[model samples]
Target: MSSPSAAESFPAHTSAASQIFTTVLSQGPLTRSEVARRAGLSAAAVTKAVRPLIEAGYLVEDVDEDARPALGRPANLVRVDGGRALFIGVKVTGDKIIGVLTDLCCRILVARYVPLAARDPKAVLGSAAELVRELLIEADGLGVRVAGLGMAVSGDVDRAEGVVRYSPFLEWRDVPLAELAAMTTGLPVTVDNDVRALTVAEQWFGAGVGLSGFALVTVGAGIGCGLVVHGKVVAGAHGVAGEIGHVAVDPAGPRCHCGNRGCVEAIASDDAIVRQVRAATGVQVADAVEAAGLAHDGVAGAREVYARAGDAIGRGIATVANLLGPERVVISGEGLAAYDLFADHIRDAFATAAFGSAARCDVQTRPLPFDEWARGAAATAIQSFIRSDANQHLRGAALTQPA
Candidate 1:
């Protein structure tokens, strides 16, 4: 595939330039003064940074006659030219790989899903490369080049290194995914924890937008939490943070895959719920779906199992609220299929456990389809592309070198 046009680069090399572009991208069609105010930059800085971007066709300016001053000078609104570049994002799950093609603004243009025949790194990478190839073809049809690719997987991922440090579902360890995918797809690649990547998308364009602090807790195959603190995603020093799944809620609870007992995940994860339901009901409940079905049927043991799982989840979320004191918590994930069964328990337990003002944090649920996860991956790619300094820092010798 051909590289993106020079105009597509957006001249986003400096921090000021990137910041100006981001301000416009997120809160666009704004006058220079508004951009300066939002970005915390001077008017001169905004002008200097926006000039090249506007000249490169990445930003378009519109004159606003209605907002004209008494001096008769029209206010010009600056906004991102969404057609300037294209990108591909992929979210790999245990069952399928969801892919999306997006514009510079991270708007989804096309989406596709491919079943995973295997869980090994090699197989998943091949599947991902093929998906990228298909998306690139779509980009070709759109007469644009794909500037970058982002892959999101659930686990302890080293985004800076683009490695899957440990993915329990895929049974992968220390896989240099970004380098391999970059070699195959010939595009700059970024790999991030699935939930964190999703949180980035949420923070910029979804639920967490304009919020200084928030938490996204996903309950499904695993209990995942993505935390945004001070308007930034919290990536711990070791590339792992907001791992609420492993927060032990009960010392004597079931064992978690992470070798911890009584973890929220151990009690509320899909597999955990299924395991407990089976044991409690003395029935062969194959999966979460079946367990939910039994619970909905008003089976005594199955209902109690879901309620217990909900309690664990609520406690986990309360822990997050107590510690972070975020303004809101958005609960999502596939497990929402059984939400009816445990919704009350989640709210009740949370209300009981949350401390003081933390209990006032807005708790809501939004069901995001798998395609949204793919869009989150695209958001990460856009982030890396815009933040050149961070991208370069991530590409250091330690990360690029083979072990």
Candidate 2:
């Protein structure tokens, strides 16, 4: 078990309370009646849920001066107190570690980045810890306690177990990341899949807000997807839901690090693009950046490689649409930098592959930088802090003695 630096407890313990709080966190300065209407709960229940949170300083209620009537008192508006506490979120990529300090509202206050010299667990952890310490110093200057730390890694992450089951990008397997990070940082740690963490952020404050079903597809070092079904992020029986990158689109295209052939990731991921570019153009490129540069400079083979990758990505996305039919699919990640090279191919292939109304599932692009990914990690920590199931395991809650 890990120990937290500060002992802070969220007062709302029931599902209704969490739902109410989440409503306010995402859509507030809402009035109690508005919260009740949005949350589908009685006004009394909203009041009950808001009281404890307000008393604990997690929420603040203020008079809506602008809404004051000529003959009656103004309605009180309820909102989360973003500065009540702090959290640290770290995103571990193959070559770098990004960390951010965020408040209860998951707003980033400070951000730091460190290059990783190696992908070994120890090396990555060491770099992450240094970046975390820098953020901790920033938090200390703000005089806020960082209640928790969240780490997001690519691949099969078992958030419930706080383990990295398998990360092909990092070449890690069965790593107890939470326990180790907790020991080093002396704060409660939550480990989650990178895309899922980003989805949590999306659900609360980004494109997926108020949407019952949506998908966040990332293209960069890896092709990843996170699904929200029935307003909840889906974690399959083994916490490996929405592995769109592994969707096999071709049998003889290329080999994926996951030991699969012609998967979407094999052709669309950054490394994959670099590999294919080198083969097609017979030019050795140092990284995806150089490969993209070559394509931007009108290199024939390089552009063709990107188009082919786009086709694979489009097919993989169509597979998602055909299977689940989400309301929207938001395409994002570092790869969007090269979107111009393949956007047409992606749209054309998606149009050809999508069936019936599935093609109308609103596809759009958004760019989320590394700092935003770090903020996503913070959002996971915030989700863990407020959700009921997570409350039981929070270090402070675990040590509290019932009155």
Candidate 3:
């Protein structure tokens, strides 16, 4: 497993300090008063916490030229200095690996893609290591050291233990990804479930900002989810808090690779859709794109397949809303490319299945570039660098923020 960089420690002295820094990092360029208000801390506490961060160059302050009053000295705005340190985030998919070089603020500075011809552990790790080295050279050119590497993989991942318990798409099990990556790159590494990594980014800067309870549902190769309850991302007892993809929606539906029938992923995943489309139309479709092509062409069987997938996805989302009562649900991922085909069916199923006020939960669809998931992986690396132990024992603790 990996921890913070060996030679440096975050400037903060306590978890509260880390949280304060996080507040400034996410919603900054504000007066200290605003920082205190959002973080629910006193002004004195905010100042004390921010001092070291500013001194260390992790945070900076500037005159709010427009907000300056004519009668008094201008107030300064506090914000994270993006160039203080560098990080690398990588997202591993079935066919390729997406990597991004990011600054301390989790903003992407450079991105690279590597095709993976093999899914074995050794092959995938080799490709990722090469990509990391390429980004490291980019970091060297910028005169900054990459403090950490974060790998986001789709599967049941135990971040605290830094293990990939199981990844169906990669056909991996019990892979010590963090230790291996750290060895290969000579940098502290953080390995996390892809969707949860994305959630961390969403919670801090994307759609889930300021919401105490929300769910992020991703539709694509797999229908995954990430949940935030009581102001903390839920990893659950088994690092599977939001396995909405595995939730059974139809008792008599198709069998899933996990040996379960009617799981949401079985009916709505890219592979599942292609399989169903081929079966329904009695034609051999090549992939999800080809399957969706039939549907958009007004083929009755193809449209029915998409309708079924949408219904399943909606039911899975409703299960989260009904169970957690989140204030909002954000739908994202690559599958959004075909959202128009099944958008109505998903909403209809959710409306019919939701119980009580859960039906009122606001659901929004946000289209993000494919590289966004890699950026989320970098967010997790930023978290690991700032708070070395925040993810340890996550199954039983509540960490309100990533840092």
Candidate 4:
């Protein structure tokens, strides 16, 4: 991707402006006073921050019909103009790359998927560039410039540096994905950990919205947790936080790919479940879907394997709750396809392991399809665009107004 042009820069600058814009973007169509109140900025500050945004066409103010004044000016509501610009996001999994074209507000306009022929960094980047080219064509049809691109991959990604430090699944290390993708496609790029990127989408528009603290735990090929504390996603000092999957629940448990024994992922990840089920049932359960089916059909040992996986997962969650005290935990992922087989066990284990008020944390499930993950990648791009200080190459271009 090529770099974003000077004219396509995102203009929402300053902490107050970003805060106000985020409040309105996430909970929008609110009056300036409401924006100030919600964002905890003075009304004057809200007005000051909103003017440039409105002038730049990034924000729009509409007169409220319900609360119109007969004599005075109508109450104008400020909101993000979703059609003003466009962004592209890509979520890379071991098997496929899911891409989404989104508006300024992170609403999905078009979604596409392509199978990955290989996991090598070069191959992945080639496929990603191709996918982005396709989305850019879609953006052209809508007559909007693609302002930025976000790529989300699993593992230890340093979003600040736009580097995939190490991805066990992809066997990648120190890949400068952002810079490479920028070269391939002509847009400023933001690369982030897949789960954290997803957490950004959740924080702004999904289950984590309006919550001061919450956790999203994904169960599938891997067990991943995204934590929101005090309304900010905790990236940890090392860019690896809320790694409940690596939390050792049983000292004598199975070995994990991370070189740990009895970690949550060792017992609960898709591969772990498959391995355990095959050993316990003496049946060739080829994959998670088959294992789930076997358990659903009252295969005795197969059900036990799911129960064990659930126990490990619940313990991992309890560890998160004990430490963070989040108000809720949203359980999701492809693994939820077999949720019925292990819901009771997860609940039981969590209840037993949780300490005091931590047990009160609401645990609910929501299935976030791959498209949402792709949308999450878009959200990160939007985030980086708004917070231009982080990416230096994008920063220079971000100073200009969008045309």
TM-score of each: 0.94, 0.93, 0.93, 0.95
lDDT of 4: 0.87
Ranking by TM-score: 4, 1, 3, 2
lDDT per residue as tens, model 2, 1-403: 2234445767878989999999999888798989999898998999889998999999998976888868766778889999998989999988889999999889999888899999999998889888888887787778777777889999899888788999988999999998788767667788899999999999998999888899999999889999999888998888899999999999997888879899999999999999999998999999999999999998879999999999999999999999999999999999999999999999999999999999999999999999999899999888888883643233322321111
Candidate 1: clashing pairs of residues: none
TM-score of 3: 0.93
Can you tell me which runs of candidate 1 are displaced by over 4 Å? 1-10, 392-403
Residue 127's lDDT within candidate 3 is 98
Please state every model's RMSD to the true fold in angstroms.
3.3, 3.4, 4.7, 2.7
Quote the RMSD, in angstroms, for model 1: 3.3
What C-alpha lDDT do the candidate models reach, one value each? 0.87, 0.88, 0.87, 0.87
For model 2 the local lDDT of residue 320 reads 95
**Alpha carbon lDDT at 312, candidate 2:** 96
User: What is candidate 4's lDDT per residue for 289-395, written digit by digit as tens?
Assistant: 99888898998799999889999999999999999999999998899999998999999999999999999999999999999999999999888788776443442
Candidate 2 clashing pairs?
none
Candidate 4 lowest-lDDT run of ten:
394-403
